[model samples]
Target: MLVVTTACNLDCAYCYEGGGNGQGEMMDLDTALRALDLVAASNQPFHVQLTGGEPLLAGELVFRILEYIRNNNLPATTAIQTNGVLLDHQTARRLHSFGTAVGVSVDGLPAIQEQLRGQGAATWKALAMLDSERVPFSVTTVLSSRNTRDLSTLGMALHSMPAASAIGLDLLVQKGSAAAKIGVQPPDAVTIRSGVTRLLATLDVLNAQRSRPLILRERQTVLKALGRDEARPYCQACTGSSLAVTPRGELYPCTQTLGDARFHLGTLDHPRLSGTALPDGRLPKREECAGCGLQGRCPGDCPSRLHYNGADGAGLVCALYRTICDYCLYKGEIPS
Candidate 1:
C-alpha cells in the first residue's frame, strides 16, 4: 500500500486523508521504481495499492511505475484506489494496458454521491469513460448515514453500469475532513448492522441476476450470520498478510496508518529488509470489547478512526455488527 501524493484535485467533504490538503511531495518515477525494487528483493508475495489525495492526478507517473514493476518481474499484484473523477477514455485505456485492477471510491448516485464525494459530473463522466473503454473496474462505497438510506439506489445505479465488475461497501470512518461536517458521524453499531443487512439483501438480488458478483464486504456479518469464522469476522488489517508503502518511501503495517509518521518503517530502496520489522500497535481489544461474544470475530472496528477521533473502543455503530453476529449465531448459521 502506497500513497504517491497527498494532493487531490477535489476537496471532498469526507476526505479521509487528513493532511491531504492536496499539497504533498509527489513521488517521482525513480522513487516509485526504487520502492518496487525493494519489494521484489524482499522475496514477498507482495500486493501494492496506489492511493493518493487522488492517484489518477499522477496518471502518467502511475502508469510508468506499473510498467517498471512488470518489467522488473516483481512478485506483486497492483491495485489503484481512485475517486473515479479523473478517469477518461484515454486514461482508462492506459490503465487497462497495465492490467491494474481499479477500485473506484464512489459513495452513491449523483444526488447522494455529490453530497459526500462532490464533483458529481466528473465522477459520472469518469465512470462513463470506464464503461466505454470496457475497462474492468470495481466500485467501493463509503457507507455513511447520508448514504445509508440510499443503499438500494446506489446498488441499482452501479448495477446499471456495465463496466462495474464488483461492488464493495465500507462503513464511514468518521475522521479528518469527513468528521468535520457530513451533517452526521459514523452511524451507531445498530445502524451500521441494519444498513449492511439491508444492503446485502439488495446485493443478493443483484448478484443472482448478473454474472458479476456483488461485493457487500458483509463478511463479518455474513460469516456471523452463517456460523463460521466468528473471532476474525471483519478486516484483520494487521493480522492479514499485506504491506503498504507511503510516498516518502516508508513502509507501514497497512494503509490505515499511512499518513501518520509514527508507523514509518525503513525506506523501500534499502538493500536490507525484515519481514518482522514493522510494528502492529493497533488498538488491542479493550475490556468492553473482550467480553462481547462478537469480539472473537471483530478486528475491533476501525483502529485509525478510533485513534484519531478519540472514540470509545466500543461504539454504537459496532453494536450493529454484534447484532448481526448474534443473529447469525442464534440461527445456527455460524459455529458457536
Candidate 2:
C-alpha cells in the first residue's frame, strides 16, 4: 500500500517525487483505508510505505492510516521515507507507537548535508529524537560528486549515531532532480569505481569498530563481496514488486514514475493495476539478457529507470554491476 501526498517542508536537491511547497492533492482518510483493504486482499505480504511529497505534511493523516491498517488485521510492514526536516518529538512518538520504522535521508555531515538536504537543524533534531525514542531507524545518503568526497565523513556521522541500525548508500539516480535537468550525469565509470572503493574501505573501518554495516547495492554488493552464489534481487521497477500511489490516489510502479500518467496502475482505493504487464515479466528469460553471463543472478537492470531515462539494451550501470558480480562469483561468494 502506497500513500502519496504532495506536501513537504524541505527543498532537498535530490527529491524525486517533486513535492515541496504543497503542490499535489491530498487523499482523505477514507480513501487511504480502502487502499489498505485492497492490499490485505492481495495476499501478498508487501510493505506499506507511507511516502509523500512529504507524508507528514498531511498532518496526523499518516498516524490514522497506520492505525487503520493495524486494526483491520492487514499484514504489512509499515515504513516511512522522510527527509527528517519536519519530525518533532510529538510526531516521532506517535510514529514509534505505530511500529512504523523510519528511514531518514541525510546526505552527509553538516556542510555537505546542508547543501544537499535543507533544514539541517531540523534533521539533526529529528535524528536526536529518534535516538531518544529508541526508534529503530536507518540513515540514507545519496552519493554525488558534491557529496561523494564526504562518504567517510557521512559514515562517521552515522557511526556516531548509536540509534541508527543501518546506513543505505543511495547512489544518485539522475532523472527528475535538478541535477539531471541541468545536465548532470551520474559519475563516470572511473568515478563510480573510485567512489565505491572509498565507500567500501570506509565501511570496513567502521565495521571494525563494531558499528552497523552500511548497505549499498544491497544483495549485489553483499553477495559479490562474500563470494556467494545467490542471485541478485530483480530490479524493483521491472517486477512491480513495489508501487507508488499519489496524493490523488493514482498508482505508479515506483516513485520515479509518479507524475507520469503513462505509468498509472490504478486508483489507490481500487488498488488494482491497469494496462499491460509490468516490466517484471521481462525476467525469467535468461537468453534475452544480451550476453550477460550473470543474467541468472542479476536478472536485468531496473526497467523503470531504463524506461524513464529512455535507455535500451544494457545500461551503463550494468557493466559495473557485472564487474561486481563476476568479481564476487569467482571469489566464491556464490559457491560456483
Candidate 3:
C-alpha cells in the first residue's frame, strides 16, 4: 500500500496519521517513482492501496503516479481510499479511466457523518457525483458511538447508494486521538458482536426481498476467522510481506505503524537496513492455537481481538471468540 501522501484536507477527530499533521515534505515525485520501481522489480503481484491524510488533497501527484503505472504497464491492481468530498467530475473521470477503485470514508448520515468528518453534505455530494458518473466505488463506514446504535439504519442507507458495491464497517479506529477527540472508545467485544449481528440482520431483511443484496465483506471475513489453525500475519501488518511506503520514501509494515520510528523499516534508498523493523513482532503461537478442537478450520483472522489482550490474546479472547462463532453460525451466515 503506497501511502502516497499524508496531507489530508479533513481534520477527522480520529485522524490516525497524527491528524495528518506530519505529512513531512509530502512524498516527492522522485521518492514515489523509486518506490514504484522497486515494486516492479520484485516480480511479485500486489494491490497498490493509495492512501493519505486525504489522497485527493494531493491530486497532481496522484495522477502522475497513476500515469507512471500506465506507461510502464505495471502488474498492479490500484485503488485509492479517499474521503470522496474532493471527487469532482473531472477527478472521477480520471480515476475511472485509470481503473482505480474508490473507497470512500463516510461514517453515516449527515448529522452522524458531520459529527465526525465535519463536512456534512459535501461528502455526500461526492458520493452523488460518483453515482452520476457511474463510477464504481464502495463505502467504508467507521462505526462510531454516533452511529453505533443505527448500524442497521446505516446499512440501509448504504444500500441506497447507486454505485457503491459494498459496505466496510470499521466500528472504531485507534484508541488515542479519535477517542479523546470524538469522546469515543473502541466498542467492547459484546458491542462489536451486537453490531455485526444487527448488520447481518439488516442484510437478511434485504436479501429476503431483493434478489441480490449488497455484500458486507466484514461478515464473510468473520466467518473465515472462525476457522483457523496455523497463524498468518495480520493483513497489512506483516513485516516485509505487506508494506506501506511513506512520502519521504520510508517504509512500514502497515500504514498504522507510520510515524513511529520503531516500525520504520527504512527509506527507499537504504531499504537493506530494515532488519530492525520486525524486532520479533510475530503473533505468538500459543497452546490455544495448537490445541483447539476446531482450530485450523475455525476463526480465521482477528488481529484486533488478539491484540486486545496484548501478547496474551489467545488466552484472553478464547471464550469471546467461541461465543462470536456460535452466534454467527447460528445466524446461518456461516454454514454448519
Each candidate's number of clashing pairs is 22, 8, 14
Question: Which residue pairs in candidate 2 have backbone atoms (N, alpha carbon, C) closer than 3 angstroms, thus clashing?
Answer: 226-333, 227-332, 227-333, 227-334, 228-333, 228-334, 229-334, 238-280
Q: List, residue by residue over 1-336, the lDDT tens digit for candidate 2.
A: 465577677766756654366466776887787667765777877688887777777757888888887887677888898888778888888888888889888877767667776777678778878888777788877656677555666666666667777766554555567435542334455565565556656766786776455454443454653443445444555545666666677877777677676777777656566552356423334233566555555544455555554442234455345545544545455743
Count backbone clashes in candidate 1. 22
Question: Cα deviation in Å at residue 289, candidate 1?
Answer: 8.1
2 versus 3: better lDDT goes to: 3
Across 269-299, the per-residue lDDT of candidate 3 in tens digits comes to 8885345333223345566556444355443
Ranking by lDDT: 3, 1, 2
The candidate scoring highest on TM-score is 3
- Candidate 1 has its poorest 10 consecutive residues by lDDT at 272-281
Instruction: For each candidate in the order shown, give its overall lDDT on alpha carbons.
Output: 0.67, 0.64, 0.68
Better of 1 and 3 by TM-score: 3
State which candidate has the highest lDDT. Answer: 3
Question: Cα deviation in Å at residue 71, candidate 3?
Answer: 1.3
Better of 1 and 3 by lDDT: 3
